[model samples]
Target: MSRFAGRFSGRRAVITGGASGLGKAVAARMVAEGGQVVLWDLDQALLDKAVEEVGALRGVALDVSDPVQVAAAAATAQAALGGVDILVASAGITGATVPVTEFPLDNWKRVIDINLNGVFYCCRELAPLMLAGGYGRIVNVASVAGKEGNPNASAYSASKAGVIGFTKSLGKELAGTGVMVNALTPAAFETPIFLQMPQSQIDYMKSKIPMGRFGQVEENAAMICFMASEECSFTTAATFDTSGGRTTF
Candidate 1:
């Protein structure tokens, strides 16, 4: 289904984490549907590569956790694209795995800052623009861990849980407005993020999934594009799970 087939022909989008993984997949899909895209990420090399792959799209090196940097990036994106019709906040990190009692404070904070706070920073700066325009869509990438905490991943779970709450609250606040806010709770996806974790941890995660396999970046991207499209008019403040039945509730 081409939900955004011709819908984004003249529209513009801002995608964080667009350098790779799920973000890159979503940005590619958006561009395929004829939208002008601005990709934001912290890795300059990856961003350069993504720009090359996604021809005609702009790329910016942005640290989402830094409010000043996020704000500046948003401004630059708006200036370049004229204005953002869709904002996909996909920049995130998988924190080190360990029991809560043993979890390092620095690691916890880093995870929270990147996964949750970064999303907030983007929203805080971009929401107003959408509200003013009286039309916008925000799709934040969350995780199934947010709904059901993983055994040895307190920081990642908590941060993603925060994303759920944040999305819900913001969605309600903008219910009457034209802007729609939503989050995607995806299970383990075979992305570069997973490469950061140990093989044992990866194996454990895959075992827990009912599908007995990791999710694909394209699968997650499909859902994100739907939520970011104009057709997603009624669904907001909700978590759309793509967890391969890992989260049936």
Candidate 2:
């Protein structure tokens, strides 16, 4: 709430996949707290709507899965924001929900490209800017499914696991550089990402949470905001769990 007021004064942030769901929620909070944010997503229409709704600096539509597009978008963002102080690599997807043997080859690759590689591209292109500025915070949105792989969601699980690993590696590389990197591993949240899943799978995930309910977008945004803030300093190559007692490790 108002507690975040002025916390991000004069800060510039970029949220990949900010068109909706957790990304949008994070963007809104950043702006509300005096941060200027650029929203990135694949859907042009939704991107426009979110930018308007969130009062972001602007919205850029690009496929996070494409390295070339990601590179260009990063350039555009750097130019637009005059140098990003924070990066929230939240762009991702939940691929087909089927047994590993039944998972489509195309689906697996697509999920990995967006959920994992997309994060790398964002961090790769932006971390240097933070280093140059001598300050930065990177929050990569992963999932509990990575820690404990969910059945029939091999691609999503694998991609998120990669994210967790990547965050650790990047954190070590940026240690003591005023650039902190961390991963957020959350259980199922009632976001649009759930639309891609089967009801059975959704029920299965809910059952895993001790809270017996899905996380709210605001709840997710709260943890992410802290991770992306100066308050999160001294923590890197680590994961912040928000799984409602489902994952203690």
Candidate 3:
């Protein structure tokens, strides 16, 4: 993984939810490319360890759903990195799994707050940094559920759908600003995040994938890195698919 093609050399990146799973994988890759990275996650202990593990410049304990935390972290990043060239809004969670009518209101709000609003807050606070530099790449991690709603996961589905829409609007807003915004709609990947789901739900999602299995974290990191790289030039506000044919739209 340390081949170092220098694809992200001298780049500074902040990846929310960089403690583990897909986010963690991306952080490792970016660092291997000679980029400076800061891992942002809600758990202090996890963040501390991930920064060391991924060789990231540092780790910031951030709850992106909290605008104050986001703003403070944005300032921290601005001061530390001086200028950020990449942002991967990958922090999120899977709330309780249940029928919409049976869904807990508290659970719904929590999911939306973290999955949808968190992405918005990070972009809101950090996009200005990118705009100021006149060069940036943002890859918002969404899900195939956003495109094809998953029953019993209403909040998760709706929140991710919001991410896709947000990415589109922001992409266009920064069209000529040298900052590109895009999103990924990926199929279920077998990560610790997947362990949060019920066995039945996991099985259901895997069945939908034409590949007849869940995706790997490395498979996801590959797409995410491409989206975060300078090579992503010419594409903005678009939804890239990694759903193994479960979604082609």
Give all TM-scores, in the order shown: 0.96, 0.99, 0.98
Number of backbone-clashing residue pairs for each candidate, in the order shown: 0, 0, 0
Best by lDDT: 2
Best by TM-score: 2
Candidate 2 achieves a global lDDT of 0.94
Which segments of model 3 are wrong by more than 4 Å? 1-4
In model 3, what lDDT does residue 109 have?
A: 95
Candidate 1: tens digits of C-alpha lDDT, residues 114-171: 9999999999999988888899999998999999988888899999999999999999
Better of 2 and 3 by TM-score: 2
lDDT of all predictions, in order shown? 0.89, 0.94, 0.92
**Candidate 1: residue 178 Cα off by (Å):** 0.8
**How far in Å is the alpha carbon of 47 misplaced in model 2?**
0.8
Question: In candidate 1, residue 19 scores what lDDT?
Answer: 92
